[model samples]
Target: MDKKLKRKVLTASLVGSSIEWFDFFLYGTVAGLVLDELYFPSSDPIVALMLAYLSFSLTFFIRPLGGIIFSHIGDRIGRKKTLVITLSLMGGGTVLIGLLPTYAQIGVAAPILLIILRLIQGLGLGGEWGGSLLLAVEYAPKGKKGLFGSIPQMGVPIGLVLGTFTLTMMSLLPHEAFMTWGWRIPFILSALLVVFGLWIRAGINETRNLKKRKNPGRLPNYRLLIH
Candidate 1:
């Protein structure tokens, strides 16, 4: 690949992965700091907090399923398309979460919806990491494979830093305002990041392997793999 194309692939890989992870981690931060109050309310703050954590844990278990589903699509369609789907799914989930009604407003439905959103976020993330990693690695020149392989990994720390920074800045608000709306801003603002990531990803070419492996009948049965 030419230098220009390589740079575009690298940028798309890193930025797309980072944005997806940013959405994923940002939910955890919100779950820890705000979910208990907004989604799961109890007289015992401890109980509410624990419930929120439990919801977060549930997302973890659902991730594998997401990975399998998306990977199958990636195998059949292409990495580029699969990643676009996952990123869009993740972005939609995050924005919906930001707009979700609180427990006080919706009673039992609040926490239920929160859990569903978390699951969607988990699924998106499960598929995203692998695609991003491959996008970078597969696009690299023969000698630079190792270097490119490591680039997508950078998304982890970058995402954590961005999530932490966003929360910290929002923390500057008073407790009432922070809980009321400040926390939601970060989640909702993810729309812009998602849009940018998708734009970059759209410009990237599918990996050579995916382009060459378009025979669905020749692909392994994902259901068997899952079983």
Candidate 2:
């Protein structure tokens, strides 16, 4: 692979992974800070917070299932295509969450729908981390593989910083406004990040390693191992 192309692929992987994770972590932050007040409101504050945490934790459980499903898609279709699908799914979930009605408006349905969206977000992310790493490492030339592989790893901290920073800025709004509408801004704004990620990833060519494989029929076994 050409040096320039390797750099492009690495950048795309890093940026896309970072954005997906930012969307993912944003939910965790909001669950403790905002979800209790809105989606899972209860007379007892402790119960509301516990419910919010439970919803957040559910995403972690669903993530592996998402990995299995999307890994299958990656094996059958291609990594680039799978990454696009995951990225879009994650972004769509985040945006929808921002638009969701509070418990006060919809009663029990609010928490139920929030859990569904969290599952969608988890599913997207489960597929994203592996795909991003592959996108980076598979494009590396010779001895540079380890360095390229680590680039995607940087996404975790970068995503944490982005999520924390965005929420911090949004928190500057008055408490009522922050609780009422401000928190949704980050989730809705994820759509723009998704647009950028998809555009970058669209330019990435399929990895030559996959193209060189003579037996595409082995993909189902790969998916099973993921399970």
Candidate 3:
């Protein structure tokens, strides 16, 4: 790869991951609090919280699945496509959640829809982190893979912290408005995030390693590797 292009790709890999994760973690911060009211209104607080937490946990647990799928695609096809797909999955899930009706509006179906969206989130996120790091790592200069990988990893904490702050601020609003409408702010804001993630990823070159390799023509060996 050309020197300038490689650096450009590296920047995208790093910044895009940061932005994508920022959007993702935002949902995590709001997961239990807002989802309970929006999705499970008919249930008691305990049940609603429990269900919301389940959905939250599901996102993380499903992350491995996304990793596997994205890894295969990344290793086989190219990093660029995999990242695009992952962003689409996550962005779509986030946007859909913002549009979802509350239980008051849709009864039991609200929580059901929320769960499905959560599944999409889990699947998308599972793919996102691994590929984002791989993209950066593969583009890094000689002997700099470790550093490049770390750079993208920073996005995780940055995103998590930003998400925490955003949620904390939202929590300050009155309970009624916060529950009824304020919760939508974060979800709605994902539009800008998705657009940003795309801009960073746009027109960038594929990872050098992926470009050099021929198709592997097989699913990734992603199963747990217990000895």
Candidate 4:
């Protein structure tokens, strides 16, 4: 790949990875503070907090499954397509959580839906990390593969910082307002980031490796285990 195109791919990979992690970590930041009260309320504040954190933790288990499933799809279909789907899933779940009605508004169904969205977000993230890293590394020019691979890793800290900074800013609102709606702003705003990431990723062609594969055959879980 040309230097210009490699740069574009690297940028796209980094941006998309950052956005995904930002959305993923946003929930963790909000869970103890806002989700407990709004989505997982209980008479005992501790109980509510635990429930919220439980939702946060449960997603971790689903992530590995997501990684396996999406990796297979990436191998068979294409990394670009897989990355787009994962981003959509993560962004879609985040936006929905922002728009979701609270337990006060929807009763038991609210927390259930919130958990479902969290799982979706987890799944997207599970797939997102590898694909983003691969997208950067695969497009990298000789002698710079390590450097290009490191670029996507930057997204982890970048996303964490961005998520924390956004919430800190939003929290400055009056407590009632912050609790009522301010918390959702970051989640909703993720849509714009997703759109921008998607636009950037859409411009890049499929990596040469996938294109060169004449027959990308299926590799089931059992086969993977055997290997």
lDDT leader = 4
What is the descending lDDT order? 4, 2, 1, 3
What tens digits encode model 1's per-residue C-alpha lDDT throughout 130-188? 77776787777777777997888898889989999999999999999999999999999
Give the poorly placed runs of model 2, Cα more than 4 Å off.
218-227
Error of 1 at 203 (Å): 0.9
* TM-score pick, better of 2 and 3: 2
Tens digits of lDDT, candidate 4, 45-156: 9999999999999778998988888888987888899999999999999999999999899899999899889899889998898788777877776777789889999999
Name the lDDT of candidate 1.
0.85
- Model 3 C-alpha lDDT per residue in residues 1-227, reported as the tens digit of each score: 57777677767766667666776777766767777767765437888777777877777778888788788877677778888888888888888888888888988888788888888877777778887777777777777777777877877887777677777888889999888888777777777877777877887877655555575658763331110
Residue 87 in candidate 3, Cα distance off native in Å: 0.9
- Measured over all alpha carbons after superposition, the RMSD of each candidate to the real structure, in angstroms, is 3.4, 2.8, 3.6, 2.9
Number of backbone-clashing residue pairs for each candidate, in the order shown? 0, 0, 4, 0
The TM-score between candidate 4 and the true structure equals 0.94
How far residue 214's Cα lies from its native spot in candidate 2, in Å, is: 4.7
Residue 77 error, candidate 3, Å = 2.6
Expressed as tens digits, the lDDT of each residue in 108-176 for candidate 2 is: 999899998888988999899878876677777777778888999998999899999999999999999
The deviation in Å at residue 143 for candidate 3 is 1.0
Best by TM-score: 4
* lDDT (CA) per prediction: 0.85, 0.86, 0.75, 0.88
Candidate 4: regions farther than 4 A off: 220-227
